[model samples]
Target: MLPDLAAMSSTSFQITATTGAFPLEAGTIFTNTVEVNTTLLGDDPSNNVAETAATVFPLLYIHEIQGSGDSNTMPGAIVNIEAIVVGDFQDNDGDLFDTDLDGFYVQEELADYDNDKSTSEGLFVYAPGATDVAVGDLVCLTGEVGEYSDQTQLTLQGDLKICGHATLPAPVSLTLPVRDISDFERYEGMLVSFPQALVISEYYNYDRYNEVVLAEPFVDERPFQPSAYLDPTTEADAIDDAASLIARSRITLDDARSAQNPPLLRHPNGAPYALDNRFRGGDMVQDATGVLGQGFGIYRLQPTVAATYIEENPRPDASPAVGGSVQVGAFNVLNYFLTLDDGSDICGPNLDMECRGADTPQEFDRQRAKILAALEEIEADVFGLVELENTTGVTPTADLVAGLNDTLGAGTYAHIETGTIGGDAIKVGLIYKASTVTPLGDFVVLDDPAFLDPNNTGVPKNRAALVQTFQDNRSGETFTVVVNHLKSKGSDCGGAPDDDPVQGNCNLTRAMAADYLVDWLSTNPTGTGTGNNLIIGDLNAYDK
Candidate 1:
């Protein structure tokens, strides 16, 4: 029978070490030792307590202590121990055995026994009710030391131990905003920051009643510099004022990096202003406060100081009397075609008498009769007709001019033909009285490159503008007349999905032609430099 085992109480323990005995008094931490053991040494009867008593002691170490009450009610001490083997024990298979057997055993001598191995010296005790513990934490345990065959162990009785607090790590810093154009001044020639928002408060009377209110952010700004001036103002004064402001504000870098240039400010109302192109119309100069408000705004300015004095020079006067009163009429005569078989038939071979069929003799007579009557009533000095066709190709347009002049009796009319490549079958024609307004020469044809192909072709193959210089009968003053026919409704040649460009083709073409005419008129001054230039034709473009 086994000796009566002693009952252990819950208490704390102190730990000390000796070569032959367990050094822990009451409470100390317990850790796993003799890591290679396959079974609990104290429970194996084959290697009983008597066998362990004769074995040499193993090394033991205290790691923690445990207790439930005062020191007097201490449970036991927990210590980790390792055994020393004289020779290896053998199994039936002849494999060498190196672990604990069973029963009470003496502790082995302490030595550095492979501390790197986690199962050996590295083993730790986890506290009771605690989730986890780190490598270096000092733990305490309460238990009794016992031994099996070749190993020493601890018998745990009560609660285990733990430390309260945990180790933690340090906290982290955050960056700031930068300055841009909004923080600087905005003005032409001045270093001022560009206007973040250019607001157009009012756009007064543009194109008579059409007004446009507008605003935009200042995308560009520069320093102002001048070269020369024109008649009215000196370039030096303008440059001085501009340079002073520019020096105070930031100077804009030149586009080519060649020189210092002033910024250009475009007004919402179609006016452009810059230090170089400064005139008085739509740009503002700031007061001492650097605020640009209303009043005589600069329209255009030149960079060279010498360019500032350039003025609109006046022209010399000339002769007044002689030419007859000229009346110009623009008519879209629908369709006027001469017959191929008989010259007398106006509507040609297939039309009906009522001007409804493809071409007929009676229809020709009816149209001609009406045209003659209208001509007699208006007594037009010049006529512009559209949609005139001929059988011989060139004959019809000439015939109409001849027929009208003959019918009128006194007026001598001539048809100005536009030399279009394959458009002789039907074309836009001009007829004018030679006696009232002498033709300054021949007709000038305007060419349009936009409608060079069929997909862009429709009512008008391509746009053409006719320019004729005529001597006005009443003033003897020569006047320039321009007749234009622009593009018509059709599919867009631009290959756009909606065909929006072709839908507005006529208007766009007409506007372009008008712009060309304006440019020409500005350059060409006629008849004492005061004669009127009239643009009369079936423009086919709405004014809007």
Candidate 2:
């Protein structure tokens, strides 16, 4: 206090104290005050006093705050707790969450665990500012409990003090297809290990989200699209029960970051997620250890250790040959619209519906090339295509046929003309090899309003189902091919039985469409009156 500063010079120091020396009890208020007086004129005495206060609260256990349910028990309540850091992800690098989650994960020491199976002992500390804590470091922090995006977190109210280093808790071993979905709640924010081999089930979001769905090896036991198997027309509770099993059997392996389209994407096996080192669906991962986290309404794992990967599902070089005189194929040419999806509404049959395919001619050409390449590989005598533009002249179906004939010889392929079957922006189409198969009768469409829109509002629920009879020139045998593009589960129909968490949206509409299709085919919709009938196309349902 006796040191005097010269002309605008100042000094910095720290005041330290030990709480044990004062014998203060819990719930007690402790305040420290300091004042400065200078002998200079107009020295701004108003800023001379500085004071700080800290209220002592009993140090609570991590499980006490986490409770036994999905949410924190003591939300908004201030607490002082000590734990060992398990995950040190507090760096400001743009890798985690696109720009740092600005926090780290801490869990109660083994000796301090409450030994409760339901309540979790781990917590995420939301410290935007830097902290010198590392994994295995024993630390004490005072913070208020809060929930962020359905995840429980503690916001630091003061400096986090590292007391000493300690051993990390053993990772909790877990397996997929748990008895119940709530089983994951107890392990949230905790270090968990899956010893069983988990198969990569989906990578639809890997390009943008850098995440893949991991599931059990057996498809029957894992979470799958329900409509693919459970015919909604059947009277069974299996559809509703599938949701529970799906929730328990599925979990996502996140890239430990939330960035979209990351420059470098890596799998949990330390392999780059690229075309060369691809981990396609059906690849196996063993010994996956990670911090179980919940975000974006789904539970994901932020890997803590590299897992072992086995390339079990290798890509096939060619389509397998079938035992049939004339080979048939079905494909969904995802929105092969002749017009661009460019903000103007001039693409559909009436030239008033909005477009939904390539945005430019160059993109269309690339898409067309890919489609033609796939078609060449199939080499089927007849093909059923979906998601084609419903325009009037030179429709997408004819354009595709032209592209095929140009690649093959002229008059190699031909398309059936239905003239925009339905009012939807997209429709189904049929094409056959003119050299292998001949069209026997005129094409027919099932536009029964009773089955599509049971309410009878005159509005079609989905694209009309097309039926055509084709004769194999080699055997001179005729068979009717029913091409269907039923209603998708993407959007709801604004009524009951249409939307189910397990079966997805438009279940009733699709079920009715299927029933009506079966009934209409029984009446021999095609004049060929052939008993041999084959239904093929994008049914938009899973084979559960």
Candidate 3:
């Protein structure tokens, strides 16, 4: 209500009212009218009433919307803000579908920053069709705040207005090995730079997602496999702690593209990551700068500028020399099954188990070629193999030996024939170079009840051991080789011996198998009475 005006002179005044919880959706206008009462006389009655219109919404800063927590405060609220574009991932390529995220990132200008460490001043505006904006452009837009895949974002509801251009904000500097894994949440969707040299720790997703994990090198050395250093049974807590440290120290370096198996891969040095120019796990990337983003439960750095890549860890051309009269080696031939994994259940000994490994003829050819090259390079006299298909017909071991002989003359290599040693879908195998070593008496197999499941059934849980004695041609020295495949930690056992946080699942079962092996070998199971023994193959347990 307006105050009464004196006689013929009129004065303007102000009114403050709250538009509590405007219920309409975004872009809707709310109007208000003011009228003069009968007590207040007006010269013209027609001019007594006046109305004003406004798009009912709050105008908030980026920090206010992001809040000081992991999520947004006004998630479903419609609001307006003006900020400068930081990183633009809009689909500029004329593809039918977006190759990257069809949106852009905007951050508050340095002058307008709220100066709050806990709240982020940058935000991702999910405008898939936006076209008129670029980096450093000051733009005002009305949008509804929302959470997409645990990330706070904005969806445009009204026309975005481009104000004048502004200077780009400086990116915040950060270091690896943060105190906690959640420490990255504060800088989510913001521009950040790492001033120190970081090493590539893992590239498991590089082939598929154009991404590689970067982390602070472990004590200035390459990251070692946890299982190689710590015992999963005794040092379980330490192993878990080391894993947490890795999680806190690492961040994914993405190509800023969303396409899988990109035709042209990108490297930090502005070069294509090709077969010749590849990056290993220990390569270093210096002074990396990018926009930090969270998606699919991973924190990634979408590079904004090219960085220097140092090839500190080059690919090894040949295997290291061990220097001995006879060389013995072990390899895990991961699911080397001739039976195709083509949605059929006609593999294994019973002919009813599902097959694994290559799914097509083309894939099988590629797999065989790589395996053959690796085996030839090892140059070992005797090799213990794991994960071979447990089928009755032409075995994987026979196929591998044939491929080897084709490369290195005929009668060069031979494989032991113990038909389908166990009931499991996969079994262990042994192969040797016939020219270097000769087989002794019949190969022995430890197929005791200890390998069976805890229910005392005939079904074996661990694959039976493949034991053989070999005599070196030059030295005439005999050594018994025992190959084994123990129960893995991937699944659980029933009851009190299920799984240990320290050693993982099936710890007791594997321990029991180890005990049985020691007892069986003590009884001279091979009957060669050779005290010289060598135990090998996938024990499925980590070394201390």
What number of clashing residue pairs does each candidate have, in the order they appear? 81, 6, 0
The C-alpha stretches of model 1 lying farther than 4 A from their native spots are 1-324, 339-358, 390-393, 410-412, 417-425, 448-461, 490-506, 520-531
RMSD per candidate (Å) reads 35.4, 6.6, 7.3
User: Using Cα atoms with residue i matched to residue i, what is each candidate's TM-score against the true structure?
Assistant: 0.33, 0.75, 0.75
Count of backbone collisions within predicted model 1: 81
In order, candidate lDDTs are: 0.37, 0.77, 0.79
TM-score of 1: 0.33
Better of 1 and 2 by lDDT: 2
User: For candidate 3, lDDT tens digit of each residue in 55-173?
Assistant: 35656778888988988888788777888888777777453223467777888878777767889888888887776577788888878899888788999875687878998878889
lDDT of candidate 1 over 1-544, digit per residue (tens): 3333354232222222332444433433234331112222335556332322211222234211111111111123334332221111111222211111111111112343333211221111222232233222233333354322211234533443434322211100000010222212111111111223222222333222222222221223221132212111345455555434333332111111111221233322223434454332222221111111111221111111011111122222532444546677777665676643342333312222222222557767877777767765666778777655523333555776667767766446776665432232344567777777776665565544432232443444444556667777666777777665544544333433323321244444445556765666655434222446777776654343
Model 3: worst 10 consecutive residues (lDDT sum)? 31-40
